[model samples]
Target: VALNQQPRDMIDLHARMFKKHGITTIRNFDALNDLRNLSYSGERIAEAGLHHQIVITIMDLPPGCEGAHTQEDYSKMLKDILDSDIPFHSVCFKDSSGTVHPRKVYETIQAARKMVPEDMILHLHTHDTAGIGISQYLAAIEAGITRIDLAMSPVSGGTAQPDILSMWHAMKGTDYTLDIDPLKYIKVEEVFEEAMGDYFIPPESRMVSPLIPFSPMPGGALTANTMMMRDTGTLHLYPKVIKEMEEVIRVGGFGTSVTPVSQFYFQQAYLNATQGRWEKINPQYGNMVLGYFGRTPAKPDPEIVKLASEQLDKPVFNEDPLDILEDGRPAAEKKLQENGLAVNDENVFIASSCESKGIDFLLGKAKENIRRKSTEAAKAEKIVAPTTVASADSVMGLREYTITVEGKAYQVQVAEGGGNPIVSTPVPAQKASAPAVAVKVVEAPTPGNILRLEVKAGDQVIANQTLLVMEAMKMESEVKAPAAGTVVDLHVSDGDTVQAGTPLLSLSS
Candidate 1:
């Protein structure tokens, strides 16, 4: 959380003084990147026994806007802030620029919710310039925000939120489990109304979040997410951005980020769109952090906007980028082209998707699609092909199997032929096994040794459908299917090496 906002000398002075006085301070860090500097600040915070707070600042777009707050820049900033460890007790998304859209705000908060844990408090502070601030507040509530910063006076043209009455009413609409009472709120507001007559009170705004009914976005405590997405104009590729996030989480990773890293993720889309190149990730340090920002789009009804605007005595603006050209004034793509990042015949760069995902996934997808295409194709390529169909049927007990793995090949010795099975090879037991009550086949979870076959070919199995287990990572993961399928063949015996993306066992359907 040690920041590099002001001059390094000033920070050094503070650090020295803080240490000398034995103060338990919270280091407020600006740049969450810059490892050498971040490390130094982290060391200082640790030595002082202070909690570090991070507030990642978004990069101003090359061209400045009078008051536009860019969500993309905020996203990048938040991404970078969470990417590094600074003993950050809390993170705040500050709207240094007053321009922010309601929809973008909703999406940004949701994305932030996913980036941080419940224990980590997220905060937001914004200057209202196009009047979407109240909408942003409502979006925060729906997006599961708990903490916010409001000023006593209206900032810029609009006011700081949580106007006692408005916040109290909004809380009533929310199912949030905050311990409180609205009657106390009404009593306080009555006293304030008498003391400060005609004090400005903006009405409660509509939700600014995108409608993600199936899987709701998480954190809304900050505007860093909103600023990050909007700043980058990432609202355009909203779905893809969220998709990358889900995939990252699936791989046991989180999408907490920093500004520079956020820029890296969307650089091709913005700065170098025509170049078609992505930034390289180095695992030595940043692998554990960085990448991906998302949000639920805000959908505030115009009639509602009109109602709120009239109440606040201010004009409420639409936050959707599509509206930029709603009257055919200018399209976002056209704006990009105007900015000189558009693709032309000259600036084209070579790119392909297969490089990162590998040919296997693509081929697997194509195979499934082709099989599903037509009955003729499906007849030729089965969804789950039986060993009899995929290969010539081998004898039940006597089958010679050789497994090639990695680059080294292993010769597997299998037991063969009834009474001859006992002393010839590995000791093999011969039994009738309940007349094939259930012919369950076991396959490898990942490519590894066969280890041990818990059940024989003709053994009865319950509905749970477990046959064999494989060892991967550090623990033993199970490989199970249904109990009804016929056990056609066991490819390898115990203690045989295998490769990933390799099929080890075949079950008859």
Candidate 2:
């Protein structure tokens, strides 16, 4: 899969075979700013008696630096694509990695819908790769995406496919038809099992459902899990892919298959990682990593690449290219295999839940059954009927102690305090102490990971000056100084791990 390989070459590629098997309308996970050979491929498709639908979309933003500027740039790009008059049927903003902010998905879809007419599909494809695809899709639909694709639970990964049926049933806003018989779809497993004689699907890969607005069918022949298996040799590729993706985002470069959200997570992880440099990546590294995967990301302008090269260029790199194979180093292959998390099958459906997690839930059901059996056995033991105590105003009764209740613990306590000295009914305890000082003040407008740090500890920054850049779903976001002061306690630095509510940089009050 070299860049210069001809379309005829790709036709022999297994990916094309998947395409030939009733998967004609292949949508990219994300769109590249410069399609290396989309036109050529499209032409080849026509020659091959097939329609090649190449979706042209852009990931949202770079890692750092944000303004009305970045959005205006996206709007202009949309306009340019429209003016090109290329025979593209659709354009969309794909949140494939599920990294888009809910608000951004809403606004971006709304704005794009206004720019494109109904005939040219203005669509959105979000993946719950990071476990948030459903919410982001809901936001996009609310904003407007008439055409969408989802896996039936059988094919859906991470969780079930977007609950399309449930969402449709709940909102009633969309008027779309999948055109598949619901009853027939439900019977697919029986047919498949009959034909195959065995289920390839692990119990963990099975569908779990009704989590969202609507449920799509429980299964389908989709997902890139198989290629992910063949890619076992590219052990270092995952982290490298993450870093390269972030670098692309840093320079406004885009990919058709790698969504802005995916890039956001990749870049965000890269920016926060301890010690990897960009200069280290060369043609050899690219070949080992993305060269086999796809084109190395190119930028909006070559000048951006130059600027990035300046910041990232390092003299003494991590490892020598010649010694790459010799090093018994941090490799994804051994690591992933040791953990048994590396997926090694082409047909394996990565359900929305982890494959093993399904069995764990099943274990709960088994435990519940065991409890039922134990309770049934306990029915043989009877409690003595309560009797009045001889010559006393208060009466004490013997009660049966049954540990078996449905999946929960019994809380035994007397309503009165002090070791049940006085008999009384049990009561729930009042809540614990409240402390004002324990609460941390939240900086509004703070989004995902901090992308860049403009001001360091002890540096004086102005009230409105950018203190740091953060990113959520590939969109560049900013956090500015709250007040004019020398930075005091910089709790979190650039690339430091932090959650949404964690204190980033403490400013003097």
Which candidate achieves the best TM-score against the true structure? 2
Summed backbone clashes in each candidate are 38, 36
Predictions in order: lDDT: 0.39, 0.41
Best by lDDT: 2
Task: List per-candidate RMSD values in Å.
Answer: 25.6, 21.4
Per-residue error (Å), model 1, residue 322: 42
Q: lDDT, candidate 2, residue 426?
A: 29
The true-versus-predicted C-alpha distance at residue 8 of model 2, in Å, is 8.3
What does candidate 1's lDDT look like per residue over 1-509, in tens digits?
11002223333444555666666645353322223345445555655556665554321221221222256546665676567554557776544333345566667777787878887777765533324455566777687565765433222123234343444445566675345565775576566646544432222111233321111122221132333333223334445543343222222121222322332222212222221212222111122222111111122233433443443344433232222222211232343354354432111110011111112233242112121122432342112211221332454344545455655444454544344532223222343223322333343323233444656654545544656654432123345654455556666565454433234555655
Task: State in Å the error of residue 21, model 1.
Answer: 9.1
Q: What ranges in model 2 sit over 4 Å off?
A: 1-31, 44-49, 58-75, 159-276, 282-509
Give the per-residue lDDT digits (tens) of candidate 2, residues 1-509.
11112223332232344445665554432233334335444444444444445454433343352332234545665676566634455665644444455677777777777888866666666554445556666777777777665655444544334644433443445554455555665576446545544324433234332221111111111122211211222223434444444443444334333432233324333333322444322221222132222333442335544444444342222232222233221232243345444432211111111122222233342112122332443433211221222111111332212132454334332322244433333233354433322212224131244445767766766776777755433234466665676665445455442433345564543
